[model samples]
Target: MNASMGPTLQTQGFYDRSTGTVSYVVWDAATRAAAVIDPVLDFDSKSGHTATRSADGLLAFLHGKELRLAWILETHAHADHLSAARTLQERAGGRIAIGENIRQVQTTFKTLYNLGREFLPDGRQFDHLFADGESFILGDLEATAMLVPGHTPADMAYRIGDAVFVGDTLFMPDVGTARADFPGGDARTLYRSIRRLLDLPGATRMFVCHDYPPQGREPCWETTVREQRERNVHVHDGITEDAFVAMRTARDASLEAPSLILPSLQVNIRGGQLPEREANGVAYLRIPLNALRTVGSMPARHGSA
Candidate 1:
């Protein structure tokens, strides 16, 4: 997709049709310093093959414009696709950052997946952990990390200049919001976080992490705060918090698990590090037998991995 020019930030979105994810590369055009958000490492769950095509695509875009990479930020530990943060960091030389609350996410999944005690949920895996309302520099553009937990305890939204990259907290007005049934997810919290985003100036542009386009429409990832407030079916004007939570909770119960949840979390928890190699230098993935219950089978239990 062509880049959109914000007041001070240049933004572009890449669509991964395989997982319905939209990764972004944002930079200060004047300084050419850039950061990427929620990059994907292409993983074929059926065959267990991982590829760097998606990350490489982002690199090509930055290199094409001679942008200096500064940060690879994860909005959260995703459940739909493996993070390409480590791969991007190695090639682009940028710090990897996520919300400090990622420790809680790591801990929740650690026990569920039976990870060893060697794995500490201390938020040390990433190069930096951002606190709520934290401010930083991405070239000349001022960036702030806003804690927007609901889809996951670690979820964060990055506000740069007049644009905000909101991961999984929202979708196009017609598609409504993301599901909040993941461990540590709460519909009530998500509603408030969304209100905060909507309260921004009407012209504030918003970007989303994924887009599930309904039939007969093309995928979209950019919308203005005003557009959402006026049209977002799930949380638009007059939608009470009680109404949102009730609607969101009921909807989530009927949804099936994300196709990549198991594989994604294992790599995501370690900052996108694959499992350690065994004596034979082969890293194997574990598949628990009937350990997970699908939606409507039983209430999903939360745990520490």
Candidate 2:
């Protein structure tokens, strides 16, 4: 239970195959108002086909509950998922928001993706660009965006009541925190960021963005600071900064690229909206042939060791 909390916050997770990204819908039980976080827009890499199967599921859930959606919140521009937030905003009639630092990420990737000069990195794509420590409303629930960058320059954790929707910062205690090897990612910085999250109240329920199934357990996304501190292999209570960095660097060095890294970054940096249609008015995403040779090569790992 939350400390002096009022209406309970309900959360559900949905996974998309295109990038193995997990999307969530969180709501207030009393007012029947809700917010979707990191919702997925389905894409088929082989056929170049994109759809809304996952987003449709979220719409179905909202419809079934008769909840009024107030906003679509993204923790950051994901590098392994295509957010269906805009699509949901259109259907659910709510504003979409993300961290203000997203503009930096957008600028970095727009050049990488070779988007035309007309593409702006001013964060106009999102309804609102929240600054660190910014707070907003969702019916009876009060949510604040805390800047916890490491996995990416714009990554954030949403403190909704007693639960923090920590995008990809810290995972379930048994699993540990997200890797910091992507563009603009740093293991040392991630060490500091994870500490910030751990500094929260021990009882705070941490909701994760994605969960890779462990040895034999089903995928899950909820944990707590205490549990993580005591059991998380990477950053438990007494872990030192130097120890964490060495482990993180060695581990990150052995991991493979996210299956959808190439596509995820390009779409995510644009705030989930796909590229504009061509003269034929048909939208397309580019795959730079062999561009990931060395500059973009992913380290190969032996699973989650």
Candidate 3:
């Protein structure tokens, strides 16, 4: 374990090759109080099958180390992978939590999916909702929530000790920042949020939720704030907010929707629980046909110039 002051902070990252996601387990050596950040449940979009293998690995680690699970923290509502937060809590025990702005995401998807009145947008799906700059405890480590929305309205970065779990906010310097075309996501807002994160003490360890590596490189999830500020393709030290927004918007226009966006959102908005089953005893995910517009985002409407 890496020692810091009286409490030692240690983190282990697990990469799921399928979605290129990196889930982390961060704990203190002096107390063994731990939290699982952005856990994933193995999902097969083709077969519609869900497995516990990925999360099980995390559980085994916690058990092996005799660590007490305190929080199952989600940085945001992901569009790429199914969340294993609920499953992890069930097996290992932790309070499921996410950014308070998840209500905005939940409300957006609830309308898109035409969910019944039973599904509330009150953020009740989670055990706790953290607001921006909220302070909390992780064993002996002090943590704070920094709302970094842009990829989505609810994205948050958790700062614990010298480490930060930045959920889809910023990526490895080469991979750049996350696309900010999702509903309720503004390129300008995201750029500002990212700049705020980069302004932190340079040596701060920034851990990303997903890593899309370049051809010559293997997946990497760790980068320092100093490195990101110096080399991040999307928003480095010299990149202005206006320029970043233009680049981000243009880039998002050319990108296709994530392969698992539909399935992931339906499940994730419910705090990783599948939609309630019908009388047939089966839970089903709804795919709203053409519900998401991706044909062309040309700002000029129709023939207007």
Highest TM-score scorer: 1
lDDT tens digits by residue: candidate 2, 165-213: 8888887777787887766777788888889889999998887887776
Worst 10 residues of 3 by lDDT: 296-305
Superposed Cα deviation of residue 264, candidate 1 (Å): 0.4
* Residue ranges of candidate 3 with Cα displaced over 4 Å: 1-7, 294-305
TM-score of each: 0.95, 0.91, 0.93
Candidate lDDT scores, in order, read 0.87, 0.78, 0.85
Error of 2 at 64 (Å): 0.7
Candidate 3 lDDT by residue in tens digits, 62-161: 9998999999999999888999998998888899999999999898888888888989998999999999999999988899999999888999999999
Clashing pairs in 1: 109-305, 110-305, 111-304, 111-305, 112-305
Q: What is the C-alpha RMSD of each candidate to the true structure, in Å?
A: 3.2, 3.1, 4.4
Residue pairs in clash, model 3: none
What digit string (tens of lDDT, one per residue) describes model 1 on residues 186-242?
A: 889999999998988999999989888889989889999999999998999999999
Task: Give the TM-score ranking, best first.
Answer: 1, 3, 2
Pairs in steric clash, model 2: 254-300, 254-301, 255-299
The per-residue C-alpha lDDT of model 3 at residue 282 equals 85
Better of 1 and 3 by lDDT: 1
